[model samples]
Target: MKVGVVTFPGSNGDTDCIETLKLVEGCEPQLIWHKSTDLMGADALILPGGFAHGDYLRPGSIAQFSPVMREVARFAASGGPVLGICNGFQVLTEAGLLPGALLRNQYILFHCAWTHVRVSSNRSPWLEGVEEGTVLRMAVAHGQGNYFADTETRRRLVEQGQVAFEYCDPEGNTSGESNHNGSVDSIAGVTNEAGNILGMMPHPERSSDPLLGSADGRVLFESLVRSMAAGAVGR
Candidate 1:
């Protein structure tokens, strides 16, 4: 499978995302600059984590206007899959590709650590390998990872099963300590109405390798590849 990893001027995790994807057998990731206007025929697109524009305007405010974002928006609208991690998730929300917005952590600190995530839905291709309610460990690094939306939107997301993942305890349980960043309902990741777009503050690609101490993230990526490949073959 061919995936496109986009790089903005201040993007820091572009290489990491590319390397992680390349590590997957038969999966090749192409690097596209933020200035590029096309997707280069990639089957999927990943907006890797980074401090684009140095987080000048907002986490993803400046990035939403980049030339590459136009292509991303177009691709997502056409049912192409797009995964946005960390800053990438902020960008997706800023670009209007995903729902809700991210705010500073309730504690107002830069958080970086291994946080557990519970799969709330398998409706998205990105979570096909994960069963609903299964908990997986993922590394999260961000400051403004807290997500918020109006009550109606949150209700709609829940009703539609667009809530893909949530913060959880190490024992696969939900608790106060399990909810990092004080996100609303402990939401860690979510998808669009059609389940073609996914955006989350946790870095799944960062944990695709077991040597990195957490291989749980691989299932999400592998699921994406499998789901997309299946769609390609009319399955």
Candidate 2:
């Protein structure tokens, strides 16, 4: 499988994402510059986390209009797999590839730590290796990870199974206390209606290696690889 890891001006996790993909057997992941017009024939793409454009204006606001985003948008429209993490998640939302928006953390602070998350659905390509309701250990580092949407949008997301990942506890419980950024309904991640694209305000690449203290994030990339190999269509 060939995966493309996009690099914005301030995207620091692009290398980490590439390295993680390298850990997967038979997988070839390359870096795609923000200014590149094409995705270089990658089967899938990953938008890793960081302070793109130095987080000017907003987390992902400036990065949305990059030259690479145009291809990304088109790729997603054609049912290609895409995963956005942390600031990358914010970019996807701003670019209209994913629904909803990320607001400032309720506490107005940058949070960096190991967080528990739960898989809310089996429909997402990123969650195929993990079962529904499975718990995961991921690392998060962000200042504006709070996710918010209007009532109707929220309802539609839930109804469509677009709500893919939710903040949770070690016991696999999603409660107010486990809501790291005070997102509505404790949403940590979500997918598009077709489940071809996913955006979440967490750093999965950072946790892909067990030596990093957690390997839960590995399943996400592995799942995507499995989906592409099987030519699985969206649910």
Candidate 3:
């Protein structure tokens, strides 16, 4: 599998995302520049975390207009798999590739720590191998990771199984202070209607290796690889 890792001007986790895909999935990692129009024939694409354009005009507001995002948006429209993490999630929302918006943490402070998220749905290719109600230990570091959506959108998201993950306790209970951010319905991640695009606030690349404290994140990456391979066979 060939995985593309997008690197914006201020992206800091590009290397980590690249290494995780290469080492864990044994897939070819392509470094895609934010200014380029080419996708390098990537089988899957990842928009890693970090402050794009120095987060000058709100998290992903500036990065959404980059040249590369044009192709990324096209790829997603054609059913290509796209994963956005942390600030990347903001970009996806800004680019209109995903629903809802990420707002400032309720506490108005940057949250940086490990938290548990339950697999709310496995309808997305990114969470194919992950079981519903499974708890994953992942790290989230961001100031605007809170997720919000209007009444209808939120209801449709749940009714359509677009809600992929939600902040929860280690035991899979989705309530209380377990939600580090004030995400609506404790949502931690969501997928597009087609289920090919995923936007989440947690940093999966940071927990893909057991040495990094947890290997649960690998489940999503591996699921992507498997989904791509299956798609190739179907084609």
Q: Number of clashing residue pairs in every model?
A: 0, 0, 0
Kindly state the number of residue pairs that clash in model 1: 0
Q: Pick the candidate with the highest lDDT.
A: 3
lDDT of 2 by residue, 61-141 (tens): 999989999999998998888999998899999998899999999889788989999989767788776788998899999
Ranking by TM-score: 2, 3, 1
Provide C-alpha RMSD values for all models, in order. Answer: 1.5, 1.3, 1.4
Query: For candidate 3, what is the TM-score?
Result: 0.97
For each candidate, the alpha-carbon lDDT, in order, equals 0.89, 0.89, 0.90
Instruction: Give me the overall lDDT of model 3.
Output: 0.90
Alpha-carbon error at 141 in model 2, in Å?
0.4
User: Deviation in angstroms for 206 in model 3?
Assistant: 0.1
